[model samples]
Target: MTLKTCSRADGHVRAFPLARTLPLLGALTLLPLTSQAADQATGEDAAGQTASYETTEQAPRSEYLSDWYNQNVTIIGSKNIRFGPQQVDDIYLEYEFFGRKGPWDLYGYIDLPKFFGTGNGADSGIFDNGSPLFAELEPRLSLNKASDMDLSLGPIKEWYLAVDYIFDWGHNSNNRQSTLYAGIGTDIDTHTPVGLSFNFYKRYQGDNYGAANEDQWDGYRAQAKYFLPLATFGNGAKLDYVGFTNYDFGSDLGDRDASRTNESVVATNVLLYSFTHLRFMAVARYFHNGGQWNDDAELNFGDGPFHVRSTGWGYYLGVGWQF
Candidate 1:
């Protein structure tokens, strides 16, 4: 018996400027601390000492940087709502620094945001969402983008570094490719009720099978994320928003060719709930990309010219655990 395949395409590109602004609007909606406190109350004593002593143990306290290295693990999965339908699978390992004197953390993970199940020679599904399709053609679906494995290390106080390896096994073209990456980021917390971070990264790809013009490429990226706390849900739930963008520069060709540029943006909103042993988070994301190198057609498919570009919008939800 022959197996039937899902007809959805893998990567379809669309643009919406309004969707990019939603995350910022959500960030501005966070409730103030005073309002959050009003949601719950306890009996008070006439003696000030009684009030102070009673709440001391429950008050939120600053954590030392050294607290980041304790052993822990996290797993997450996400599904997209677009026509082609995409999903992301991730696994992470974490460790914290000793003694809480300073915060230090190290983590690593495997990320598969797109995977086409085997059927009709496609690794994901029947249609390729990342492709530009003509209405009359039977959509030709390609395998998922690829897999990424990464590691991150940080001194929790302000700085962090991340390294990643991306693997591309071209299911249809019979080609393979890889890239090595490194990045750095910093955080600032002087302002109350808000926090900010900035990050930058670079990547280098290995040689293509035989195409001289597409043999290799190098690029850079920059991004930022922000946080704001809102009213708690019972004991430890808060609403927050995060946003980031990546800008790429340098050569889109091999060692001797002139460079090409690329850029992409992602915005998200999350409702975060913390527990003694775990943390629950739900997030929505919007992504967009532009530039010559951004189009799928510019993609180097190892042996020859492959018409493909990287641009789109997608979202995800996740949960985390702490030890």
Candidate 2:
């Protein structure tokens, strides 16, 4: 999942030593790019570490691909995702890309919601004329690589100039969203197999659904993402755990509406499985004041009065081709 429409996932690209850190589900590179350019992991060591990934298909534009990059195309089915006062189900197509070349580390994904057009009545497909395109892009600049400095100290191995940006093309001002998060980031060398990274961002909101805070500076986000190698199978199949958390705060969302909150939190946990070209994953996410909607508040839906249920769990099941 690239979002709750707007939340977190971290990475899913095979681009990192451990992996790309997106639930940003890693986001919005087009589908055509990664297939010919993918690096597929086909071998593993006895300890479950990835031994190597073979570059497959036609190579991407050589000028655009230096160092290493990875991409995957995924289809996700999700349930109980809250939108305002309703919890809707959806299925989406996801395209992901991640890589580190020289001073730049990049991650992004494109989410085509309602791509399949079949879901809990609320679902619409891109092809079915029932959908919108949503995507997120995150890019980080490494201080160590850019400045030729040894920025590592203690548990932190490097520092980065980080940014997260999201876009959704909806039908109207109330249905669309565009946001930017800019700040600093760091990679933590746990000295173990676990990989940890954190980014802190100052938010600049844009086109936020006709809210009172639209097109203005608002809030902050603290995000933590992690990866852990769990087990590897004899058949070269592998299982790993990856996840991320987004803590959003310092907003005035509650001031204008009773059914909204000043802060929110989204945490995602994923169990991912892989074998050759195939992939499978299950995700459990927790939301508190999701979409900045209050956990318990009353509001008029125009047609009637209702209580907003903003806090709870959302689930996603995904299958993908790691091209």
Candidate 3:
């Protein structure tokens, strides 16, 4: 009586030992003892004496999970030389984690850039002065424009405590502003995964004119992002729709009482290709607010207390690669 074995993607199964088979009368009883030992070693105590394996075993799953969460980091930076409504040459850095056994995840990004002229002002060609230099030194300066950094540490498994800060300083008076934000949110798994985030922050705006009016803005912002995957492309092509709103509750300028509401919808799509990395995204934004400053007040655009109507829009096309 020789024992035979069959191996599949999961664990192997062996024919009952010749001596043990007679007691069971060839009933084909599973190797209960061996299965239980394997289960306990793998932390699957609920498996009891049953033999089972995951439908899809993703190669050294534990190692992959750890590397995916701890070592997987991405950095992206880009620059635009063409004169545009915003005249921005920016850099962005982002980090993501996908395998944490939690209802929520910690994620954040940093955006840094310089704008030569106001969003509404006529092009001073100042953004153009460095066009040639920027284009020539694209590889160098494009890596230096702006920085945005965010991190979320999970304390309650599925719930995460998030802290984010953004610093912008480039062109236009070389102004500097920083935001210190903290929030909590959850990741609810549904047909379309949903993420809800809330953040409150203190904003400090630095003035170039040596004015005593250097201001502080305290505000709260909330956002939700929904994942939409295309059935045609399966998981290869993914879409995300996000909505966000924000309001300011405090400002430093005296006699300046201000409140703002922002609503925005954005659609982002990932393109699958082997040769080139591509992504397309569109954004529609609406803003409305009043109080403290008149519609035309010379409120420092970067400072709080300024009202913005639903009259501005921003969109971008990006291509990136991972090494």
True-vs-predicted CA distance for residue 34, candidate 2, Å: 15
Candidate 2 matches the true fold with a TM-score of: 0.81
lDDT of each: 0.30, 0.63, 0.23
Q: Which ten residues in a row have the lowest lDDT in candidate 3?
A: 132-141
Model 2 spans with C-alpha error above 4 angstroms: 3-5, 8-67, 124-131
Quote each prediction's TM-score.
0.46, 0.81, 0.42
Instruction: For residues 178-230, write the lDDT of model 3, one tens digit per residue.
Output: 33445544333343333333333333434312223344433343433333322
Ranking by TM-score: 2, 1, 3
Q: Write the per-residue lDDT of candidate 1 for residues 1-323, one digit (tens) a residue.
A: 00000011221111100000111111111101011111122322333111111122345221311122222222233333221212222111111111111232222222221222211222232134311111111111111111122222342335555443433333332233344556765554544755565556676555222223333445665545455555443333434333333344554442443222343444444444433334444444443433223334343435655543324544333444434
Best by lDDT: 2
| Prediction 1 TM-score vs. true | 0.46
Off by over 4 Å in 1: 1-67, 70-75, 81-105, 111-177, 207-217, 240-242, 251-261, 290-310
Top candidate by TM-score: 2
Cand. 1 Cα-lDDT: 0.30
Model 3 residue 41 lDDT score: 16
